[model samples]
Target chain A: MARSDDEYDYLFKVVLIGDAGVGKSNLLSRFTRNEFSLESKSTIGVEFATRSIQCEGKIIKAQIWDTAGQERYRAITSAYYRGAVGALLVYDITKKDSFDNVQRWLKELKDHADANIVIMLVGNKSDLQHLKAVTTDDASAFAESNGLSFIETSALDNSNVEEAFRSILSEIYRLGSKKALEKGSTSNFAPNATQTIVINPPADEGKTEKAKCC
Target chain B: MTDDKTLFGVSDGLLPGRVVRLGKPVDWASILKASQDRERREKEKRDSSSSISDLKSSQTSIPSIKPKSKKANTVIEESSSPTDGETETGKQRTAARENSSSSPSATSSEKLKQLLAEPTLNTEAVRKLAWAGLESEMRSPVWKVLLGYVPTNLARRNDTLRRKRREYQEAVNQHYDPYLDTKEQSVVTNSSTYNRIGNEEDVTFRQISVDIPRTCPGQALFHIPEVQQALKRILYVWATRHPASGYVQGMNDLVTPFLFVFLSEYASVKDDLSLLKATDLSVFDNADEALSNAEADSYWCLTALLNDIQDYYTFSQPGIQRRVHFLRELVARVDGNLCTHLEDEGLDFLQFAFRWMNCLLMRELPFHLIVRVWDTYLAETDGFATFHVYVCAALLVTFSEELQDMDFQDLVMFLQNLPTESWTNREIDVILSQAYMWRTIFGAAPSHLQQAFQASY
Candidate 1:
C-alpha cells in the first residue's frame, strides 16, 4: 500500500527491482536498516519495510518494496506498481547477464507500471571489480539515454549504497515539490505519473502542501 | 520389479541412505484411500475457485498492471502457495500445461488414477525402500533422506554399534529368509546387549542430515481406497501441473500423508479425471531440487535456503533459524540473569532445538498425531510462529516449578529430548493450543508474512 503519513512531508514508495541474484534485497536491507543476511531465502513473494529520514527538513518516509526475481512470480508481483514514486532498477556489476536483463526489467516496468515512475539504474555488487561486466560509463550512458539516474554500489561493503538511495529519493522529492509548485493549487501530483519532470523549486515551494490545509 | 539386487537386481549405484525408523510400511490401499479423499477436496477447492473468481471479477475490473519494471510491491519472501484470487503467474503457466491436456485442474479423479499407478522399483521407487537403520518404509521420505545422510564414517567407526546394526540386519534377514522356525531377533545372540532390543525399536545415535520442513503438515488426506487412489492421481496431476517442480526429491515425504488422508473419502469414486486435472501447480518451488531448474539456478536458490543459519542447513532447513535465533537470545537473556541458572541448569539452545529445528516438531511427532497439527496449521500460515512461542512459554512454565533445583544443562537436555518421547504427551498439545489462541487474540506476529497477503498486487 502507498503511504500518505499525514505527519510527514513526503511518502516515497521505492521499489528494488533487478536480476534474480543481483542483491536488490540486500541493498534495501543495507540502506534502510544497515543490516544484511548472507543466507537470505529466495524471496517467495513481496516483502516491505519502511524507514523515515529527515531530508531537507521534511521527514521522508521511504516505503521500500522488495520482490521475487523468478520469472513466474512476476504474474503475482505486477500489481504492486500502483502509486509507486521511485523504482530502483538494479543489476550485478559482476555478472553481465544481470546487467543485460536490465532492459527487460525496464520494459516490464513500462508495460504495467505508472507512466511517470522515476527509475534509477543501480549496478550493485561493485566490490567484485575484477569480474565487473557492466561499467559505470556504459550504465550511466544508458541511464542518460533512458532518462534514469545511475550509480554503482556494493551492499556488502556498504559503498555508495546510501548515496544511491538518497540520490533517487532527492530526485523524486525534487520532482514532487516542483510538481506541486507548477500545478499551482491543482490536484495533480506527478507521483502517480510515469514521466520525468524538471523540479525548479522556488525557495519555499514544497511547504505549500502542508500549509495549504492549515 | 527386480527381486534381487534392490529391485529387478538393479543396483541404485549409490546405496540409498539408511531408512528412518518411522514405522509401518506404505499401505498402498490406505494411501489410495487418502488419494481419493484429496481428489474430492481438490474438486471442492476447484469448485470454490469459481465463486472466488466471481468475487474477484467484481472487485478487480482492471487487469493487474504488470509493468516491465523490476519491483512491484512488498511481497512475502516465502510465497510458493497460490493466492486466493488464483491469478499468480506461476499458476497461470502451469494451468496452461501442455502435458496434461485434460489438465489436472479440470478433473480430480484423473489426477488420482495417475498417482496410484503401481509403484515401479525404479530410481524413484527405490527411494521409498527401507533401511534397518530406520524402522520401516512407513517412515517419512525426508526421514529416509536423513538416515541416509548420517555420516557414513560414523557408522563405520563404532564397532559395538556396527555389531548391533549387523545383528539387527541378520535378524530381519532371518525372518524374511523363509527357512526361519521362529521370529528372528537380536536377542538370540550370545550376549545380552541384543536382548534389550524389540521388534519395533530403532537404533539411536548421531543423525547426519535433518532439514526441517515448513511447519505446515505433511499431506493429510484420510484413509479410503478410492479416495487414496484419487489423491495419488492428484499428486501426479500436481506434479505434472508444475512440471518444473515435478516429483522433487523431498516432496513425496511432505506430501505423502496429505495424499494418504485425502484418499480416505469413504465415498463413491467420482471418476472425474478431467476436473481433477484443472489444478494450478505453478506456485510451489522446492528448495531441494527447486525442481527442473538448471543445476546453476537450483544451486543458487538452494544455497540461499541452506547457507545461512549455516549449520542449521547442514542439519536442517534454514527457516529453523528465525525462531532459533530468537529462542537462543531468549535463553541467553534468562540465563544472563543468573550464570548459575545456565550453569546450574546446564542448558544449550542448539542441542535442545536441534531436532526441533531439523524437522519442526514434525519428525518428533508420530504420523497419526500430526493430523491435528495440520488442522491447526492449515487454518493459519503462522502456525509455527504460535507453536514456537508456546513451546518457549511451556518450557519455562514446566520448569518454572523447579526453576532453581535443576541445573541448566539438565534442563536443556530435557527440553531437547522432550519431543522425542513415545507420545506427544498432553503438555505439548496444551501449550501449542494455548499459543494458537493467545496469538489469535494477541494479534499475529508483526512480520512480513503477516502483512504479505494484503499487500498491493
Candidate 2:
C-alpha cells in the first residue's frame, strides 16, 4: 500500500541540529516540502520527513530528521543520532552564540552519531545579511579546521536550500561508492550491502546500483 | 484606573514602576509577583476599614463554598496554623475571594473558586474562567482541580495529595536504585540495570539524561541541582509509565510551566533571578517535601494534558500531521489570500504550525502569556487539541499583512522569531476572542480532521 515514488536505491538518514531558533525545522521544510512559514514554532523533540532525490541515475531517499535546538531537547534528540549517515549542523548567521555553539554540536555528533557522519556546517538565514554576526570566512575556516563541508542557506528565500541537501547527499553517496569499489566486484551482494550502508554507510562504491524492482 | 500605557507600556528603563515594558526582556515572574502583592495590599487597605463581622458575612454569603471545604482539612489547619504569619495562605484565601468580589481583575478567580467548589464541580464554569484568566494565587489549585489530579471532594483532597506524593517518591526511588548502587560501588556492578542494552528503558533514560539540564536552562530556578534531579525523576517516571509514547523531546518543555507555577506555592524566590544566591534556597525547612509535592502535581497535570493529545507524540506523529493538514485547510478557508500568498512562496502550515500544535504554542509565547492561556485551556473541554486550531488561525491572521509581503526567506525568519515577548494579557484576550469567532464560523474541527484524528488513535 505504499506509493511507487517511495521506492529508492539508497536511504540515508540525515539529522538537522543547532541552537534553538536557528531555523532547523524551516530548513527541513524548505528542502522536503518547499514551504516556509512566518510563524513557525520551535521544534519539541524530533520530526522526520523523507524525500527521494535523483543522483546519477539512482534514487537516493533522504530521511531527514529535524530536532529541537534547546539544550533540554538534546536528551530526546540524541536518541535520533544513531544510524544517521549525514548531519546538517545549522546555525543562524545573525546569532553569534549559535555559531559559537557549533563546536559543542560537533562534539555531540562525535559522541553519539556515526564516526564518519557527513556533517555540513550550515550558516542558515543567509538572507539576513544586514544582521550577520558570524562571517562566512569565520564559519568556513572553522568548518575547514573541523573537516566539515560549509555552506550558507536561507530556508526563507529558498537560497542554497536544495544545494545544501544535494551537496550532503552527494558527499554521502561519493563516500559510499568508494567503499563498494574496495570491497571487490560483487554485483549480487551490492544491493543488500548498500541497503545496510544506509545506516552505517560504507566508504567506497563508485558504481551506482539500481534495484531491479520498482 | 491604570493607564494602559503605564501598565503595559514600552518603557526604556531597566526596571519600570508597576508595568511590564513591552519589547524589553523583563523578569516576567517578578512582574506577576509584583502584581499579586499590589492587588493584595490594595485589598487589605480596602478591607481594613470594614467591620470584622461584615467581612465574615461577605465570606459566607459569597458563592464560593471554600470556607466549608477548608473546615474538612483539619490536618491542613494543624500544619499551616504555626506558619500562618509567614505564609498567610489561609488568610490569603479569604482575601482572594473578597478581593474578587470587590475588583474586576479578580473576577476570574472568584468565579473559578465557586465553580470548583460545587458538589459535582461545574466544568462549564471553569472553562469560562480559564478564558477570563485566573488570579495569580489561584492558578495552582484551579489547574490541579481541573486536571483531576486532586479529588473534587474537599475532605479527600488533602489525603489524595499525601498519597500521590508518596507514590511518586516510590517510583523515583525504584528507578534510581541501580544508578545509586553503581555510584557507591565505583564499579559496573549493576550493569544489567545500569547499562541497559537497546531496551525501552535505555532509549528513554538516555533522553531524560540529556533533557533534564536543558529544560528551561535559561531560568535560575531550573539551574539548581535539586531542581534538575527532581525534573529528571519526574520525566523518567512519566516516560516509563507511558510506554507507548516513551520520552519525546518536547515533553521536557511542557513539564516546566507546571513545575515553575507549583514551586512558587511554597518558596519566595526574588523576582530578579540574578539576585538569587544559591544559599537562599536552604532557608526552606521542608524544601524536599515541597519539591515532591510539586513534582507529583506537575506529573499528573502533564499526564492529563498529554492524554488529550497523545497522538501527537506517537510514532510517525499522525496527530500532528493531521493537525497541520487541518491548519492549512483552516487558513485557506479563513484567510484565502494569505494562505495563497504563503502557497505561492511555497510555505505550508506544517513548517511553523506543527510546533504550535505539539506544545500548545508554548514555544511561541512567553511563560506569562502561556500561563494565562493555559488557564482557559484547562477550562475548555478540548482546548489543547481541537480549540487550539482556532487560536493558531487567529494568531496567524494577526500577522497576515506582514506575511503577505514576505518572500520565502523573510517568511521563515519572521516565523521562527515572532515578536511575542511584549504581548500582554490584552493581546492574548484578543487572540482568544478572535479564535472564538472562527469557531463560530467553522464549527468544531471539519470532517477530514475528525477522520484523521480518529484514524491515528
The i-RMS of every model, in angstroms, reads: 20.8, 12.6
- Per-residue alpha-carbon lDDT of candidate 1 for residues B346-413, written as tens digits (9 for 90 to 100): 23343345345444454445554454344333223233333454445335444554555544323433
Backbone clashes, each candidate: 110, 21
Q: Compute fnat per model.
A: 0.00, 0.07
| Local accuracy of candidate 1 as per-residue lDDT tens digits, A1-214 | 1233323445567777876567877888898679875534344334565666767776666667676564544543454554566889988886665677789999988875557788999999888997776788998898999998889999999999989888888777777776662332212432321111111111212222322211
Model 2 RMSD, rounded to 1 decimal: 16.6
Per TM-score, the best of the predicted structures is 2
| Alpha-carbon shift of residue B84 in model 2 (angstroms) | 43
For residues B4-122, what per-residue lDDT tens digits would candidate 2 score against the true structure?
Answer: 11232122221111121224333445544643554455334433343222222233223232323222222322332223352343233323332334344546556566645643333
List ranges where model 2 is wrong by over 4 Å. A1-214, B1-102, B110-120, B178-199, B269-285, B444-457
